[model samples]
Target: MSEHRILKLFFFACLGVFVLHFTMTLLHNTPEKYLTPRMESYSHLWCYPTFHQGWALFAPEPQSKHKRMEMRYYGPSGWSEWYRAEHICMDQHIRYRVTHYSKLCHVTQNTVYHLWMAVDHFDQQDRPAEQFYPQNMGYGIAMVLAENYAHHFLPEMEVHTLQIRLILEDPFELQDPEVIHFPTKTLMDGPE
Candidate 1:
């Protein structure tokens, strides 16, 4: 192939991948009922690190609420003060050039979003809180991530159980903030 033709072909291929990536990301993030079985089957592609999509820059809908993830740990000394993971990650990101700090900021955002979605699902079904925690994937992931984060940061304290709470406040200051409490997960216990 001629050089010009090769360059043109490469451009189109790059464009194709860009378009496909965003299209798959949109479908993957959409409600499952809206997707056909085949599309739903490919949803896992977006979960890959290379293809991951986030809404911080341009959300489909504007974010109207400020969400914060706060965690507290229970040890022999009793429950510690609620630690704001988001703030810590943001501070680290601001102070250092390390990429892990930025990644943790994104992780905190995803954790809050996942936990909130799980909460909304349970609320709509009128499910009991006891039954919701174990069955929800988001809850399970959040609990484990939160516990690990606590253990990593507060190594001196032995954390038996960690509790996470999502604080949602209106970005415009139009309403009072609401706190969604999650069950305290036992981190020291072995897997069931």
Candidate 2:
């Protein structure tokens, strides 16, 4: 193959990767923050606690709300600006059954991590959608029961629970992690 052909092939490969990544992100029911009323004033901050103890396997259980959404981290000032109704959205499934609980993570200075708000809820067809409405879409909580990576799938010695904390500052972090979430306890019942 000619040098030009090789370069062309490499360009196409990169393009393909980008497209696939974008499509997957959209399918994951990404919150269109750019379209929100708070976009002009929104910010995010985050953190991840060391989980050498064990992982908290979260899932939407019976008699609970099976819902999750992105909770952008903002400093104390930004958090103060947030009103429960103005900032967060619901999965509707939990509208009548369970109350939702959410908390933001705090990381060490100069540190970064993915804030696992929740995974996108998949439909009967296994497609991502909150309902019939694309805007209502979001991910469910990922079940993390412990912290260990015995599987070769993870880099040896690097297989450990992520100490990621995501902060959604108005400026936003240039890079971030893609952590997932799963519902834990029902909020309606209150205190475990």
lDDT of 2 by residue, 22-119 (tens): 55444334455544434322211111111111123442332112112232222222221211211222222234334321211111111111112222
Clashing pairs in 1: none
Lowest lDDT sum, 10 consecutive residues, model 1, at 48-57
Model 2, global lDDT: 0.28
Q: Which residue ranges in model 2 land beyond 4 Å of their true spot? A: 30-192
lDDT score of model 1? 0.79
In angstroms, give how far residue 156 of model 2 lies from its true place: 56
For each candidate in turn, give its C-alpha RMSD to the true structure in angstroms. Answer: 14.1, 20.6
Question: Which candidate's TM-score is highest?
Answer: 1
